[model samples]
Target: NVTVIDAPGHRDFIKNMITGTSQADCAIFIIAAGTGEFEAGISKDGQTREHVLLAFTLGVKQFIVAINKMDTAKWSEARYKEIIKETSNFIKKVGYNPKEVPFVPISGFNGDNMLEETTNASWYKGWEKEVK
Candidate 1:
């Protein structure tokens, strides 16, 4: 069974995220490509802003980077690639092997590439099948 517990996203919930991650088998870090830092709520080190990023930075490779809100962004490939590159470098700085963790550009709100149908992200392959 997959347990999905939606936690608070504010700064006050940082502790909750740490605990949640500690007990979770896997996590999907959701983000928005168009909202800039609004999605992460952090800048500069990126770690300081993204509470979840902090989780992965502290060693949470069993997670998938879900780039959400692709629909609102009009499915901009450039935006997708930019965030991917930024996140990749951020992960590497924290001593993680980028290849181990998969980053998928998706639209959580529109169910894009989620559980419904394939999204506009045709330029990429899937990690679920690769893992299997």
Candidate 2:
């Protein structure tokens, strides 16, 4: 069985994020696919990168990089690939092997690629994790 806890993404919520990381067994970092959002979130001043670094430093080993709102990007496989490639490099720089991290393409609004599959991401091979 798995349990999930949320950590806020804003810079002002860094403390809460750290608190959540401290208790988390795994980390799931979300990147938006909307125009300009992803870059802004990973920028020097953004909290996304900082959160990942903190989670890593806090010894959260397993990671899931969820690329959300793919529907806004028209469910383009190229867009998904682009985000994954860019984010993977950043993750690798932070000491995690990019290949070992799971990259999930999801549309939170439509609920695609979560517990059920959808043609919205036909190119994606779905993810399944064995419960321990």
Candidate 3:
């Protein structure tokens, strides 16, 4: 049985986030790939970095990073790679093994790479196979 909890990412709801994460076996971190958005999220004051560190501290051992908003970035492979490189480094610092994490480029707005492979990201070999 799988229970999925949608924890709020806003800093104001960090207490609620912690409560939810404490019960999670895995975390699916959704980071935006839009121009400048990714940078802000990974910045020193970003909630992405904060939540990731919180999840790690609370012992959420498994992580799947979904780099969303690919449609905004026009599904560029370079943008995907850039987010992966920077995010991998951040997660590594938060105690996650970069090799063990599954990074999937997605577009929640367009429904790409959410449940199946997206032609938009042809350059992105599906991470699900590697994860399993």
Candidate 4:
């Protein structure tokens, strides 16, 4: 079953953390592809690790990582891969297999690689089953 929650980041307001994550079975983690943003989000002080760890602890085993705002990073595959490498390592540290994770390159504003595939992300492996 699928339920969408616009859960606030731990840094934003952690008061809702427990309630928001309690209902989730999986996560669509949207990290940016821009310079510094990706790094900052996964850093020790960032909410990404805390929130993801919380979800995992709460039994949210599935994950779909959406690397948003590819446009900002000029759709550089290098940048995408870089973030993926860093994130994959961290994800593994949290006890998940990096190979099973789906890291999608997207531009939320332009909807690149959302439904239809975009040339910008032509290298991305296409057509995984939608989350249901």
Candidate 5:
């Protein structure tokens, strides 16, 4: 049996985020891949860093980072690489091995690489199969 707790990323609902994460064995961290949005998320005041720190502190170790909004980024491989490069150090600092973690590029709105392979991201091969 699997239970999914969709915790809110908003700073106002940090209590809810803690409650959800404490019960989770793993976290599927969805990071935006859009031009400016990605930077904003990893900024000093961003919720992304806070959420990751919270999950780690709450004893959740496993992470599958979904680089979402690839569609908005026009499915650019360079953008995907950029996100990975920028976030890898921070992820490692938060206690996850950068090599072990799967950074899958996805589009939540367009449904790319969610449950199936997306032609839009042909370069992002093997992750879907390996993850499953």
Candidate 6:
């Protein structure tokens, strides 16, 4: 039998969590470069955040941190480096090796750092270049 599903762990449907985690071969983490951060903790009614952070924390082997929203932050190398610094610390706390982590800052809003020639990312290399 072969079936696949795509949905996050949440009160609306947390059942996916068990099956998703158990069956998935790998995971890709997509974080925004500027905003869209959902605070880590239980909500007012005690509902925990259904976020990829937990999955990443639990040790997803093939996690690629896609930092979206770079245009909003102005596509600066120093800013991206700062994001790397903070994310590296978080990855360590979540039981992952910071050295093995990779990051690519992309602006989904403006498509600035997208799948094309990014004029501003002179300081950082492209995503395909990361693995090699």
User: Relative to the true structure, how large is the alpha-carbon lDDT of every model?
Assistant: 0.68, 0.85, 0.89, 0.84, 0.89, 0.59
lDDT of 4 by residue, 31-50 (tens): 98887888888999777788
TM-score of each candidate structure, all chains considered together: 0.76, 0.90, 0.94, 0.88, 0.92, 0.65
Give the candidate order by descending lDDT.
Answer: 3, 5, 2, 4, 1, 6
What's the lDDT for residue 66 in model 2? 86
TM-score (C-alpha, index-matched) for candidate 2: 0.90
Model 3: per-residue Cα lDDT at residue 97: 86
- Global CA lDDT of candidate 2, please? 0.85
Model 3, 24-74: lDDT tens digits are 999999999988989999999988898899999999999899999999999
Q: 3 or 4, which is superior by lDDT?
A: 3
Worst lDDT window (10 residues) for model 2?
Answer: 123-132
Q: Residue 73 of candidate 4: its Cα lDDT?
A: 90
lDDT of 2 by residue, 1-132 (tens): 777779988778888988888989998888898879988877886667888889999999888988999999999899888888888788889998787778888899999887788787778986565454
Error of 3 at 12 (Å): 2.0
TM-score-better candidate, 1 vs 3: 3
Q: Candidate order by TM-score, highest to lowest?
A: 3, 5, 2, 4, 1, 6
lDDT of 6 by residue, 1-132 (tens): 544546564566766765575565565555655543412322233222234454654444655666666777778777677767766766676566667666887777767655676776787765453343
Candidate 6 wrong stretches, greater than 4 Å = 1-5, 8-18, 35-53, 56-59, 127-132
Residue 118 miss distance in model 4 (angstroms): 1.4
Which pairs of residues have clashing backbones in candidate 2? none
Question: What local lDDT score does residue 83 receive in model 6, on the 0 to 100 scale?
Answer: 68
Among residues 3 or more apart in sequence or in different chains, the pairs in candidate 3 whose N, CA or C atoms overlap within 3 Å are none
Superior by lDDT: candidate 1 or candidate 5: 5
Better of 1 and 4 by lDDT: 4
The Cα RMSD of model 4 versus the native structure comes to 3.4
- What's the true lDDT of residue 46 in model 3? 89
